[model samples]
Target: MAVRILHTADWHIGQTINGWDRTFEHAFFFKELKEIVVREAVDAVLISGDVFDNQNPSAEGMRMLFHALADLRRARPHLTTVMTAGNHDPAGRLEAPGILLEEIGVSAVGMILQKDGGLDLSRHLVPLKNAEGVIEAYCLALPFPRASDLPTLTGESAKEAGSPIVRAVADLYQRAVSGAREQIGDAPLVAMGHLHVSGGDESEASERRILIGGEHAVPATVFDESLAYVALGHLHKPQRVGRDTVRYSGSPFPLSVSELNYKHGVDIIELDGDSYSYERHALTRPVPFYRLKGKDGLLVAEVEGALEALELDADLPVEQQPFVHVDLRRQTSALGLRAEVDQILSRYPVRDTGVSIVSAKEEGQAAPSEIVSLKKLEEIKPLDLFYTAFEKEHGEGPEARHLELFHSVLAEID
Candidate 1:
């Protein structure tokens, strides 16, 4: 049976922690995704995981997601959609098989596995059917690998670098794949899962996992050769791990400035019996949120040059404005650093941007009061100083009540 599919992941809707309005970016992501699905005539769409940044998304977030999915299913009723939960996700809640979603022909293998890593396969394996409703393939749904799942492997905890999480995770994945294959039988099997497959790109969100020791990174080989293609997720960069057979569709949008240079989009995979080929559908290139630091005059010159060069790529629409993070370095004696940045923001069509000023001191110049006269404000709380000077000189009413309460609490401890 010939199979055509679109692979994509990490649509963190309503994610505003990073300063950009993920809501707006998410809408753009789906708009582009729909075009890919329609353009490729996909038989299925696989979302590896992290559909929402948090377990409970905002109302607008949920509405946007449901509307998009409903629209896609409405346009293509026969399209089989599959998704799983990632480490960033609350797996048990997100992975549970939902009847409402299933009714719409969307099969979610979210958080159904127990903490011990055991899965009930009765509902996990979906026999893929053609547009004519004939069985054509099979799907094995695997959620993110958890430490609880591998009781047999002895190892150190994530805090201990020498611990066995790596070995244990690798073994668990081996067992899961083996078991899933046995349950799947002879049909051309496709494994859709939410885990890092060793080679995909890591953004700020994923960086926390890689840095702290508790996470599992699996080798691509854990997936058996019997599988036609392993649709993996968690990483934000579209990548082929060890071999082209195991690939990540990557995040649909840039998750952070760390992923600024990454090519954002989905993957179109064509499965022909024993072989498969894939192509990347480039979504719009996002504006790089930058942090630039230099002397005042040089910083302004560079900012001007950067603005002149900010042209939209062919994949991106012109109206999609870019964001920037600008920093200025100036001698303490040098003046008007704030004014210069304000001037830049006023002149540019920057969607979201911030400029920071760095103070430099010459050998004989007196230090600025903010830096050198720290003794004058040493008795004051940093919050109070900032608020009293800048925040409308807040009157000592309800606003100052909380400040007093905070001071009282600290005073008791002192």
Candidate 2:
């Protein structure tokens, strides 16, 4: 029988959009996900990482995750789930209940442990079984590696391979795969990770840039060829990198407007023997996103008129109402933008994401404008602000080494 595994990532269970709670959306996703597990008869579920939006997720977020995991296991008694920690997760917190969670058929790996002064290969290795209860595959349940978690490398040898970080990642995977093979003895191997692989599309507004081991992102080849399928997280858009077998299932819903068109979904990989294939299943968006503008661009003077002229579903409950974004021509007083948009939006039940103004002088050039709610500008990350300031002062962004130093110092502070 072909062993079927449903792969997904970037849950961000406690995530919020424009300061709005996504608990309802997450609940909707989980209900459907449980239904999928039951309907498809999946043998296993692989959650790559980013289980929670922030390291300190609210208690409600934890409860939601626990309930969802319990429900999934009950939906398919034989279904095995492998979940790992991502950059945003508190590794220890996610791992604290590991032993307890195993009772419900979940294998959560938050951090790579140590044993006798070497990496703990056994902790990262997990076995997957078919409906017949026969073990058919092995998984390297590796979590996101912090800088300290990476293996040390030095000298010309590390340099010859590539950046030390890239070489270290490749080395870690090689070692893990070797150890897994030593024990599993060639049952097809699969793996999971949470990192920015080169070529994967990113939604910069929501995702964080986690620089580790002196590199901002690593290449897809960091995975060993022996891994039949690699489930990845980090970037919000679902995509394949370097090879089709390595893929990201993307987030289940839009986390930011930059991801407005992203196909939020799950990927099912069916593996039998040495051959495998995958298919994507799109999830219905619980809340719709609307960008209000004319073919040219909505004029600021017509903003109220347009708001009055639009039609929206009246049956949608206030919480499930569509998210609205308004666009206007530049030169609209930034000072009055929020008041004007708020006054107009107050008439409708929709949630306003923000207002953006296009530069009229550069009509043909399409550039994404900063949201008019000073909140967008207020949300500028330290790194981004530093990058802009450095470029303005030095005619260029900071060099990689400079960035690496900054990342290291910041990590220490955190």
Candidate 3:
């Protein structure tokens, strides 16, 4: 019998689009995910990381997560879920309810710590068992390792340790794999990680760089050929690392405008004896993402025309509507243009809107000119200094409202 698993990562449950809440989209995605789990008859689900958009997630976000997990568990009582902590997650918070969640067949590993100041391999290794109580596979659940999470080397040992942080992380995986081999005989090994792997394509606008001293990404060689599959996270774009077996399932939703072109989905892995095979399952996006840009000569008019031509179904829920990002190329302030665009989009069924203006004249160049003043720090007023910097960047002085806010901040400081 084959053990089936559904792999996903970077749900970003508390994420927002231009200050607009995305609770509905998340709920809809979960509904679709639940159907997939049931339809596929998956034995286990692995969420690599970034379960929330921020470390300090909102109350609504927490509620949605618990409810979603409950629904998944209710659908399949024997189903097991393993979620690790990414850079966006608060490890301690995610792991606080670990004991209770483990009782319900959900293992959440936030931070891996050493027991008695030594590597405790048991904490990071999890064995996957079938409904009949047969151990079929073992998973090395390695969460995003912080600087503190890695084992420390001091005194004599520090001298011999080359790249202590990377070495400790690699050693952790090695130890976990070794332990799994000993405990579960002939069971296919599956490793889950929430860190950047060498050669993985990244979405700069979405992913937070996890590199440390320019030496963060771990090589795929650390995983070795012993592991049947490696589920990775952090990178928002789904891709392979060194081989197809070691891959990132990617984020379930587009976290940024730059990620609009990505085909968001999940991975399905089938474990048969010692061999494993996997396939990508494309997800039904709750909301379509689109980017519309204004041409060189027809700046505002082009943007307006595009917005007017967008076809949307008003009968559907707002979450199902399109998300529009309008890019304008202009010489003057495009701030006022936002209201005009909003007015036009208001007639449509779009859920959210964002406007970005790039100067047509200075398209690929730096700011018009550099501030070459030689004034000392104490010689200038804070407000004037702010105005100088703002003018240099935007090619305009600060507005009345901006000045007011600056004064208010100064007053508060005083």
Give the top-scoring candidate (lDDT).
Answer: 2
lDDT by residue (tens digit), candidate 3, 1-414: 778888999999888766667787789889989999998888889999889876666788888988888889899888889999887776777899888887778888888767765546577777776666576787888887776666677777668746666676787788777766777656788999888888888884566446343355778887858898999989989888999899898888787777887888889999989767888888888877887764432366565577666765679877667887766656366456766666666777775446655553344765552212222344344645776687678765554345446756776786
Regions more than 4 Å wrong, model 2: 158-161, 305-310, 360-414
Give the clashing residue pairs of candidate 2, or none: none
Which residue segments of model 1 deviate by more than 4 Å? 92-97, 112-118, 152-163, 204-206, 210-216, 286-320, 327-343, 353-414
lDDT of each: 0.62, 0.81, 0.75
Clashes of 3: 0
Ranking by lDDT: 2, 3, 1
In candidate 3, position 412 carries an lDDT of 75
User: What is the descending TM-score order?
Assistant: 2, 3, 1
Number of the candidate with higher lDDT, 2 or 3: 2
Q: Residue pairs in steric clash, candidate 3? A: none
| lDDT for residue 28 in candidate 3, whole number 0-100 | 82
**Cα miss at 120, model 1 (Å)?**
1.2
State which candidate, 2 or 3, has the greater TM-score: 2
Error of 1 at 129 (Å): 2.4
